[model samples]
Structures are given as C-alpha cells and as structure tokens.
Target: MNTHLLMIEDDHRLAQMVAEYLGHNGLQVAHQADGTSGLAQLQSPDTGSLPDLVILDLMLPDMDGLEVCRRIRALPGPAAQVPVLMLTAKGDPMDRIIGLELGADDYLPKPFEPRELLARIRAILRRRGDGGTPAAGQSLRFGSLEIDRDARTVTVGGQVADLTSYQFDLLVTLAERAGRVLTRDQIMEAVRGRELEAFDRSIDVHMGRIRAAIEADPKSPKRILTVRGVGYVFAKQQE
Candidate 1:
C-alpha cells in the first residue's frame, strides 16, 4: 500500500513546498488550501480516502485548527485513529499543548526545514506503530481499571484517565502480557522507538511514574512487580 498524506494549509506556497518535499520523500501527498474544504475532503470517502497521516495548519480562514482537530477526532472508528501532525505559526507552549490535547500526534512550528518536518512526522508514525491498536474482542481489565487497545485509552472505573504518550504505551505493553517478566531492556524496546543506553534511567523514571498513577500503594506496588537482579512483571497476585 502507498503511504498517503493530506496536507491542509491555506498558504498556497507553503502547502506546495510541503507537498512537494513529502512527495519527494516517497509519500503520496494530497493538498487542500482551506480548512472547510480540507475537512470536507477528509470526510468524503470518495476524495479524502483516509490518508495515513495529516499535516494541518492551526490557523485557517474558515475555522480554528483546534476545532478542525476536534472534528477529526470525533470521526468514528478508523478515521479517528489517523495520526495528525500540526504545522503552524503559533509558537506558544499553550497552543502546542492544546494541539496535543485535541489529538494531534505532534506539532511543528512554521519556518521549520522540510527535512526536520519529515523527521518529526516519521517519529510520530513510528510511535503509533509501536503501540499497535487493540485487537478485536480482546480487552484487558484490572480491578476498576480497563484498557481498550482499539481506542488506545485507559479507564478507571468508567472514568477516562489522562496519560502522556509514554505512560499510555507502557501501561498497554505491560497489561497486554500480564504475569510475564519483562526486563528494563525489553520494556524499553517495546515502547520506546530506540535502543536503551547502559546508563539510561529513563525506564526507571517511567516505571516510577506509572506505579504512582496505577498502583493503589506506590510504596508497595501490586500491579507492577520488581524482580531483583532481573526485571519486572505485571500481576495482581505476586508470583
């Protein structure tokens, strides 16, 4: 299958540049100069065709980028799962946060080099692939907590939890293989896109954070167990 991408930006020159650059990089690019048309195209199965990725501009003449993002996320099923990379002139941290909160996988400020944009886009897609959407008829439950892999979401007693990308991936990985021991290296490979360095403490930090969030008692974790001189395991009853 071809790698399909939709670029939505009102700036004709910018859109052309991006489309050309991405195309040169071997992706089938679809361009739209306005938000309304872009939204309509995305919704239109005949024309939109559900691209693998979306490059969106936050400022549109017809609508706010945030609104566009919300509408896209509201899309049912597979359409809603398409990764979005928000390319905009807005540089405020709040704006970036809002973009991610609205379902954007990544945000790149304008004036970015085409190469950098490509790299960012690649990383976002790689992360999504690492998570692997939940399989049909397969749901994991732990107490009141639940993980719907299909939706890439976790709920606690029916209430959705706000988790960072890393956290979500970690939880899903561990829960998917409950009761199995996973070394730090294995866990890092499963979620993080790259290899772990010998001195890297990133996994430890992530584990601590996850324990704090999911464990009823962080001091004595029940769900995530540590194996001395080995690795970690996910289990309600200690093995």
Candidate 2:
C-alpha cells in the first residue's frame, strides 16, 4: 500500500508542485494551505486512516509551524506516531535545533532541490519503517538497562527513563549496534534521517542528556563512550 502524506504549505504553487511530484513517486498526498486546516484534517474522523507523514512549512497563515509541530507531537496514540519533516526558509542552526527540540523529526531549508526533498522524505519514511519491517516484539538488555520495543519504553538500572522520541530512537540505534564507532554524521543519518548540519552540536548535547539519564556516573560515562576526533560509541558490557 502506498504511504499517505499530509503536506501543509501555504504557497499554492509549491504545494501543488510537491503534491504532484510526491504523488508520482507513489505517495498519497493530502495538501492543506494553513496550519489550522491542517490540524483539522489531522484530527478528522478519517485521520486515523490518513497520512503516515507530515511535511509542514514554517510560514502559516494562522499559526507558527513550531506551534503546529508541538501540537502534533502532543497528540495521543496513533496521531502522534506520524513523523513530521519541517520546511522553512530559515537555515539558522538555532532554528533547526529548536524544531528538533520541539519534536520535528527533521528540517529542510527552502530553495532546496526537489531531489533532495524526495531523498529526505524517503529517508524519513524508511527510518519510520515504511520501507522496511519494524522490530515490534524485540527487547534488549545490557547490564541494568532494558529496552522494550513493544512498549516503546526504556528502563535503566531498574528505573524508567523519560526520553523524547528522538532520544529513544538514538539510544536504541546505538544499543543495537553496540561497540561500533559511529561518527556524528553516521549517527545523525541513522537517527535523524538527514545529513548532519556542518556546525550543529545538538547531537552532542542530546548524547550528554541521554548519558545523564542512563549512566551511573554521567561525568565518567561507561555505556556511551566518546571517541576523540571521532564520534560516540555504545560500549559493550563485559561479562
């Protein structure tokens, strides 16, 4: 079945172009010109059966895209399961960081190539398992840390850890590939479904936060180790 997509862009020309292109690429596209209407479409009775992804533009007639993103992230159940890729003219690192921090899965600067846009869309959908099977029933245990894919929860040292969607995915990706030295670019591609920003430190900041939550001693972490001049690695536990 073709994956459904909801595209919220105020520009009629851009919306029509994107919708047509994505439709030709085998996606079922639903277009909305405003955030309010987009939210309505997302909340409609048929929403449960609607889009698997949302492409949201930052400039909206009624509300900011960040607010729309927060509302979507705050939604409960299957609605919240839908991943969003933010589109904006602003290329500021702070803007991108804020979008991610607000639960946007990824961001694309305007004046981007349509090919790049397609790549981003495919990457997001692929990571979200539209292109592959999801690990739905698996559980992983390393030392006192336990990851439950079924419940979408993580427990560390017998204590439940509150993690954002991105953080949980990042931890899972790292834990599943323990002992592998994943560079920042690799890690960003793995978890965020896009290329890393040249000067972004959001990944490092998130890693630190995850360590503080899961590691016995965040100052001297054992599970997630930093490799000098490289990136981060999940250290395999020694039995």
| Winning candidate number (lDDT) | 2
210, model 1: CA deviation in Å?
12
Q: Give the winner by TM-score.
A: 2
C-alpha RMSD for every candidate: 6.8, 3.5
Give the distance in Å from residue 191's predicted Cα in candidate 2 to where it truly belongs.
4.8
* Candidate 2's TM-score: 0.80
Please count the clashing residue pairs in each candidate, in the order shown. 1, 0
The sequence of per-residue lDDT tens digits that candidate 2 reaches over residues 1-239 is 77889999899999898888888888878899999998887877765575888999988999989999989877766676678889977556676667777777767888778788888888777666666755768898898899887676789867887555567778888988999999999998887666787787778767876887788888999999999999999989822
After superposition, the stretches of candidate 1 with alpha carbons farther than 4 Å from their true spots are 46-48, 130-141, 144-239
Model 2 steric clash pairs: none
Please provide the root mean square deviation of candidate 1 (C-alpha atoms, Å).
6.8
Model 2, residue 166: what's the lDDT? 61
Candidate 2: list runs displaced more than 4 Å: 134-137, 149-169, 189-197, 205-229, 235-239
Judged by whole-model lDDT over C-alpha atoms, candidate 1 comes out at: 0.75
lDDT of 1 by residue, 1-239 (tens): 46788888888888888888988988778888877887777787654488878899998888888888888878765677677888766446566666766667667778889998888777766666632444686677888778776666777768876554546777888888888998888887776555655554446555676676667787999888899877788895532
